[model samples]
Target: MNHFASIARVPGDPILSLMEAYRADSHPGKLDLGVGVYKDAQGLTAIPKAVKLAEQRLLDSETTKSYIGGHGDPLFGQLLTELVLGADSQALAEQRVGATQTPGGTGALRLAADFIRHHLPTRGIWLSDPTWPIHESIFAEAGLQVGHYPYVGADNRLNVEAMLAALNQIPQGDVVLLHACCHNPTGFDLSHVDWLQVLEVVKARELLPLIDFAYQGFGEGLEQDAWAPRLFAEALPELLITSSCSKNFGLYRERTGALLVCARDTEKLLDIRSQLAFLARNLWSTPPAHGAAVVATILADPELKMLWSDELSNMRLRVASLRDGLVTALEPHGLAQRFAHISQQRGMFSYTGLSPLQVKRLREEFSIYMVGSGRANVAGIDAERFAQLAQAIAHVCVE
Candidate 1:
């Protein structure tokens, strides 16, 4: 008998399964709101102008294809640290912050999880109830006890009060994983006042904050989106931030990101970075070079940096417009009240509040592919098809 024959098959992820189903859908107008990817008005994920230019420059000024390092690109780590923490951050000035590039946000998260499990063995992690689904599995896979704090309510609304209440009860010195900007699956973000309140609780309880800054520019403006993380860095003596270039830089396939570690002093930071490098050696050895190099090239050059910023701003504006447009499209159908939160929510996703049955109807009857939980990718909404999409939404919402 074969020894390896008893492995059980696991079901595919609902989101990826939805994508497969959407692809097999022969409907000419099938819309895909399942995957958490940005799509333009024309329904294409085009590379940014700056990214294209940077790639060209890289091709021309090509050098040896040697390995980057355990920390990948130093320039990328430095630039991304500033981008996430702000240039004037005292943390940077004090040399208390350090970064190590990972494969992507997911990899950075896994790195952080493993680091915590290995180093801070006693500390459990607290995540939002409806956080990016991967957060649960990542920490658990690291053998860390994962607890959830209330975030979104049963009504599919931002229950910040409940979130704070839960946070208050978390064990002291536990790692609290937070979406630094643009809360995923449900685009509801905390206000400035809310951040301050959360900060107070974290300070009081002495919880370690592990911020996941995936969609920085996709929320508000670039600088504005960094507000919460910057605030956290300033208030806390130590922090762990995982920043991704997937959404903002359109480097989705490149898998470029970094795990940022902030300590009370340079000594602690260096030790933390050494441990991360050791764990990373056992993981991927070194992160991919192409994507990080592209990001560094764009950010270091003044002209390319400006162009990239403008492109990022365009993507942000487009997503915001899509959210507003969907809400407006529903107004004439008398759904303004029912779907007002769509306009209010931030980033690519919206907890549209459509029931599972309704979501099934939308996919089967209207060829609109969205998560069964009604988390639609607002970025995938085609500008010209707003009215048609609204009609489908209204029909299902009423049925």
Candidate 2:
């Protein structure tokens, strides 16, 4: 009779909780640098013009509300795979690759986790020591044993040597999750040379690579950012890739993403895709179609594709500029050098080196909000308030 009463209450998401607190604060100069979503200079998350145009076209041409099925929208899958791996990818030419549309990158990841849990039952998963919080929970919920490799060292900088060492020690055949670019929470990314070394280790140890490519065009240009994953796909016989269109296409609420698989040949690729379709059917039944339709429309047309690319480039530039502007603003307080890593780091986030106490002080006294771990969304920074934000940071640094 009391079966439900025995369940315990779960804690709210830390980032979302921070958002609620920020909204409740009455300070005129309150700043929110906690949530991971991209914001404009005016503190708004505006949709791209290309997406608007695509949606309008879709509305005019659409006829029915029929389901798109588990593999959802074949054209979307084809184009998105080309977008992730280059259009001229050898894997595609060889018919060794397949794609399954999912609700979002998160859904894609969950599909991968389930596939690993069911098919590769003996294998465990290895993640970065400080990956996106959801990664930890998702795999565990799927009943897979989860482990972590060192990513950031005591100095709060990328310790690739440590990462590779830990990765080397992991049991052979285990799955290792790697950020393709713009590593989450900590914006630190591996250099091209570093990736080669890691690739060597993975090959020697016989590890399965699962690349998370959530921020493709956010860190670098689309093609430039895809280098590592493309390399891995080319060098390895089997690989899993989860890609997101949230930030690049500004389709956050629409939840459009895909899980791409690369096998040794066409026959094996088909077998893997069949499994993904079955898993996807049990997860979300069918992914929402509007987002994928919009992406396909834009990417299919040359002019609209160019417009979307330009908008994405502008977003990347703005985030990069904000990083530099914040550093420059801190120079008067002699903090530029101390926070110089902020400039070197790419994408929307930076591990700002603020301690938990300092973070608390900023929230209570200055009404400035950021994760307790000091991760800040660089895209959320308002250039007009750079000086004000810098002053607040300086005050916290000295305290």
On lDDT, the leading prediction is 2
lDDT of 1 at 345: 88
User: Which regions of candidate 2 deviate over 4 angstroms?
Assistant: none
User: Could you tell me which residue pairs clash in candidate 2?
Assistant: none
lDDT of 2: 0.94
**Candidate 2 lDDT tens digits, 129-243:** 7999999999999999999999987688899889989998999989999999999989999999999999999999999999999999998899999999999999999999999
lDDT of 1 by residue, 37-89 (tens): 88987899999999999999999997879999999999999999999998899
Error of 2 at 132 (Å): 0.5
- On a 0 to 100 scale, what is the lDDT of residue 398 in model 1? 81
Task: List ranges where model 1 is wrong by over 4 Å.
Answer: none
